[model samples]
Target: MEEKSGSLVEWLAPLAFILCAGWLTWHLPAFTLSWFPPKDPSQYDKLSALFARIDVTDSMTGLFGGYADAVDWAALLLLPVFGIIGVRTVRRAPMEFESWKPLDRLAVFIGRLTMMLIVLLCSVMIYEVILRYVFEAPTLWANELSLWLAGFVFLCAGLYAMQQRSHIRIFLLYDMMPRWLQRVCDIISTTLIVTFAFFLVYGGYGEAFDKFYRWETFGTVFDPPIPATLKPMVLLVMVLVAFQAIVNLISDWNAEPVIHTAADDIDQDELDRLRAAVGADGTGDLDVTRGSIQSNTPGKS
Candidate 1:
């Protein structure tokens, strides 16, 4: 019973987020134009007027107007189905990927989604090239679509990097610290990241909400919902990053001390292969010398 309940919750969480995303996408125009209608044109300040100009009024002409019509509801509804697949894929991912927990699984899912976007981006660019050069015709949608996909790719990549523990850090001093001290440093770093994420979500909430409410566009000929969607996405991704940070901190709190050394950094397998290659000539083998050097290197071992 407990196992089944746990599985249900795992499915439910991503479903909730997907539903919320779809709801916001569907109602963004209504919320922006009707719920928080812009003030009178004469009373509008410079910024207000600029924003007002981009607001969607007609639901039958512009991007927002054709959003429901152009969009395939069946395909839109598949987002959660994709999320389910992502979660399952992560759960079964290689051990090196370290996707055991919910947070790690979520990050993997996002990373997989990013990979799909990259492929889509490449395909779009190729199609654009064919149209522009081969057929002597150009497209307005390709560039905007590529940009849109790239933005999400970048955002998802950040989350994936956090999960993989691949982000840059000056760990020179950190590797020298005692185990307890390392834990302390880890706590502090995670705390700072969480605080930053909090501020990002808090400060940007109104802006994101407003942009979505107004159905803000890019003001180009093929104007897209770049501003409206991206604003909210920034906050949403930040929240995920923050959650990953906390998960990492908790998971690694009891881990063994990671003391770095010159030898620790060296790839022994590669060095052995090199030694074998050198010895193939029947000349002096460097394995003994290399072993001595590694033994003398400064480290706990």
Candidate 2:
């Protein structure tokens, strides 16, 4: 039991790290959700005064700070949510798969990759802080470095998320259907996801290829290649995601619905003991009394 619980933790820790990294990304200004006021001008105080007055109508113009213009920061919030949710999905135990073996190995590998990206991102910021503030010399490559990391995380994690059953699904209608119909719906949905992913891969490859051909750069001191180096990853991961979706569909098709028993929602120890008494291992591999465990919810066992 200790070994089993430790195994579960091993699967969960990397996911938890990714979730924290995502939360930080969401709240941090580096991601651009936070704002910084610009250099002050004579109009700045006047604009500030106007902003203070409730009767003013040009709040939009007045809100424009710094040398340029103001923009909405709401979209930045989605980045973190996507990251966290993707990691969470990857971290979850595959109650859907009975024996850990190869399936569990794949999930763990994906989790580790996600965690590595998160750590690398954090390391960059730490380096930025030490060099920019401590050494009093800022690196122009910081922004480019961060963006590159973000792109990799986003693309690679999408595949991992799909494998973990963490992607969004509208199952309200399917949940109400009969078992056979539910399987049918699963088939249809799986087919559509594969089709969409295939097209995305095809289109994204062309787009990325063009960008690479253009020799695009960030136009900064570092002059890092923009959308050129990362383009292939975009197409690659999409293809990987499509492949994973295919595997998922095949797995689901072969898998029987979970079987629930008197110990269905009970504690693991109690469930184990009960199963032992019933001459079953509760591992979903043996048929002691009945042929199989009744399907209740996925990934619970």
Candidate 3:
């Protein structure tokens, strides 16, 4: 029987980890810097801009009027999370990957985040549609939020694509090369990826840092700091992608040579689904009894 990986429970740990990190990412820095609050009392940091300031410091339920309690709890919670789930999900999917190094896990985890963010982007657009059509009062933030999520989604998807080895490659002659030359081609490709990452990060570091420090915004009514977040995120994800490329090179060093043909692009699983959809065996016209039974079932027509 073929298995599917569409279960939500399998994603519980990654979701928890992202949530805990987000909550703490906001609360910790805000509280720690409260003693000598921002040089400008009215200014908002990038995190504060999105969430507004929650003043966890003075809330009775927020614990000791601050984030120490929250941070400590998060630490305790996350330690066991990654440890228990460790390198991968508890219930591995049929196609969920067998070897998950730390970098591989990070890539997969970010890929999942991209999926959730895509859902969030769709939700934001739907909300905008409803407001504009039904309520006649569209939100300023919705479109910008979608753009921001989309930027990160694209970056994360690139990282995921690299890890999955699904990126485009022209292998017309490369496929015919000897195994040693193939490994040579892999090394050259990996080096080129590393070179690209290095130049990108080095050249963009100053600008990304400056924008993050200044909390640069889009200057609209919503005024999201897309510049601040996306700039740094690009560099960070680029580094992760470069490292993942190296990891892939190392992992696949001994992998068997891959041969490409027009038939190779055909998806067996999809064909199986299509076969099931049409109630056909592998030899589509051979199973007469099977077809007759399915045809007789009340809804087959």
Top candidate when judged by lDDT against the true structure: 3
Model with the higher lDDT, candidate 1 or 3:
3
Which candidate order results from sorting by lDDT in descending order?
A: 3, 1, 2
lDDT of 3 by residue, 1-301 (tens): 2434556655676566556654554344444443333565455454354434433443423345543455545654684575346236533346555546778877877777677778778988999999999999988889887888799889989998898888898999899999999999999999999999999999999999877655567778876667877899999999999999999999888988889988767677665655665553443432333343235547555
Pairs of colliding residues, candidate 1? 32-213, 32-214, 59-65
Query: Any runs in candidate 2 off by more than 4 Å, and if so which?
Result: 1-108, 213-215, 258-301
Worst ten in a row by lDDT for model 2? 25-34
TM-score: model 3 vs. ground truth: 0.74
TM-score (all chains, Cα) for each model: 0.68, 0.51, 0.74
Cα lDDT over the full model 1: 0.68
User: What are the per-residue Cα lDDT tens digits for candidate 2 across 156-175?
Assistant: 67766777666776555665
Q: Quote model 2's TM-score.
A: 0.51
* Per-residue error (Å), model 3, residue 39: 7.3
Candidate 1 structure quality by residue, lDDT tens digits, 1-301:
0122234445454444455454445444533443345585542343344434433333433234433322333434666665776476444333234445877877866765676568768999999999999999989889987887788889989999998887877779998888888888998999999999999898999999877655577777777678978888899999999999999988887877776666745576777766764576764335544542234447623
